[model samples]
Target: MVDLLRKSEAFISQLSLVAIVDDQIVGYILFSKIYIVDDQGNRTPSIALAPVAVLPQFQKQGIGTQLIERGLSDARVLNFKSAVVLGHPTYYPKFGFVKAEKWSIKAPFDVPSEAFMAIELVENTLQGIAGTVEYPKEFQEVS
Candidate 1:
């Protein structure tokens, strides 16, 4: 999350969400632009949700949910077509996430199919836009 804050471009700033209490940050979520490149070399605009975090002491209290809601809501407003995530299968499905593979979309890395998920922001956006996901360059530095 910090790497995205420090290195990702301005568009990420528009969709990143935070939760605060008494001026202390309790949680954060980021939705950054990614691309889906097809065989013909066309690219579809997409977003990636990742690095959602809440202090260990704050987990299970809904702060993370609030962060995700805020982030994805803003992403829709920003006109992103779809969003992808590599997260717990059960946890993310509650937020409308589903296996990206279902749409024929694949993650850049080989992860468990259930854990690699995506959600459409605009109806039908992912209907035929399937390909490998491409994350921003700075994501390589995130770990």
Candidate 2:
């Protein structure tokens, strides 16, 4: 997964938050940049929350939530205007994700409407944003 992420141009940035248990890596989460086409077909910047993984023994311990919250906070601090995620509908709203379709934004592939989500880091950043979420080619090869 790391190799595939490293090879993608759309991977503008990436971060890994780790949880150590007994001095061993027990959890990790990654965030990567993604692009979306606007009405005129020009690319707009955004980030994607993907491939968050925790060792089976660590599941349900709030490690994933902490990683996501910290990652989003970092994105905001770095001036990222917005973020999108394809994930469990029930899980993302706690981080402020709403249905992207509400803003006319669609994922490149078919997914449950509730599973495709987005959030604005700054107020009104997504005001005029609309269109398709295009993930990096590396995602396609491995997805």
Candidate 3:
């Protein structure tokens, strides 16, 4: 993950939000650059929430929620239009992610429709956006 981030440094922007307990990192979430190609083949800028990890001991705490909520809020402030995530279907909805298929959005790789999700950070941000979600090329290497 770190290597991908390093290689994507040129085109990707990342927000690493950490949950610290007693001054030690206990949970982390990474939001990185992503895009959806239009019918015209133009790329619409977007973001993807990936590689979220919480220490085993921290699981089931609200740390993950805090990390996602805070990161999404910050992304909204930064004018990010939307975010895509491949994650647990049951867990991500709490953060406003719905099935990406609802928006005619899909991932480059085959995934369960329920496990791949998206959220519009700004009102009507995705009104006209529809296409396959493309992550940084670096992702394909690790994925």
Candidate 4:
């Protein structure tokens, strides 16, 4: 989280959000600009949700879910076509997320097909798109 904050210039700042609790920042979620390349080599703009966190004491109070909802909603208002997340398959589905493989989208790194998910902000936005996601350098640093 420190690295992401240190590098939050340019695009990341526009997509990051914090969840406040009693004047304290109890949770955070960030979305970064990403692209999905089609077989014909066309790149489509999208967003990637990563590192959503709520303090351990705040867990199970729906704070994390609120953060995700707000972030994704902000992404849509910013005109993002879709948003992707490499998280729990079952947990993310409640937010209308489905397997990225169903839309031919691929994750940047190796992970189980089920754990990778995507939600279309606009209908048919992901149609025919298939390629690896490109994350920011900060993500690779934590890997």
The local distance difference test score of each candidate is 0.84, 0.84, 0.86, 0.81
The sequence of per-residue lDDT tens digits that candidate 3 reaches over residues 3-119 is 667567523344778899999999988888888986788788898897799999989999999999999999988889899999999999998999998889989888999999999
What are the per-residue Cα lDDT tens digits for candidate 2 across 55-112?
9988999988888898899889888999999899999999999999888899999899
Query: Which has the better TM-score: candidate 2, or candidate 4?
Result: 2
Please count the clashing residue pairs in each candidate, in the order shown: 0, 0, 0, 0
Error of 4 at 69 (Å): 1.1
Task: Look at candidate 2 and tell me the lDDT of residue 30.
Answer: 69
Candidates' TM-scores? Answer: 0.92, 0.92, 0.92, 0.88
Q: Tens-digit lDDT track for model 1 on 15-82?
A: 76788888999888877778988878788888888779899989999999888888888888878879
Between the candidate structures 3 and 4, which one is better when assessed by lDDT?
3
- Best model number under lDDT: 3
Worst 10 residues of 1 by lDDT: 1-10
lDDT of 4 at 132: 77
| Total backbone clashes of candidate 3, pairs 3 or more residues apart or in separate chains | 0
**Candidate 4 has what TM-score?**
0.88
Q: For model 2, which pairs clash? A: none
**What clash pairs does model 1 have?**
none
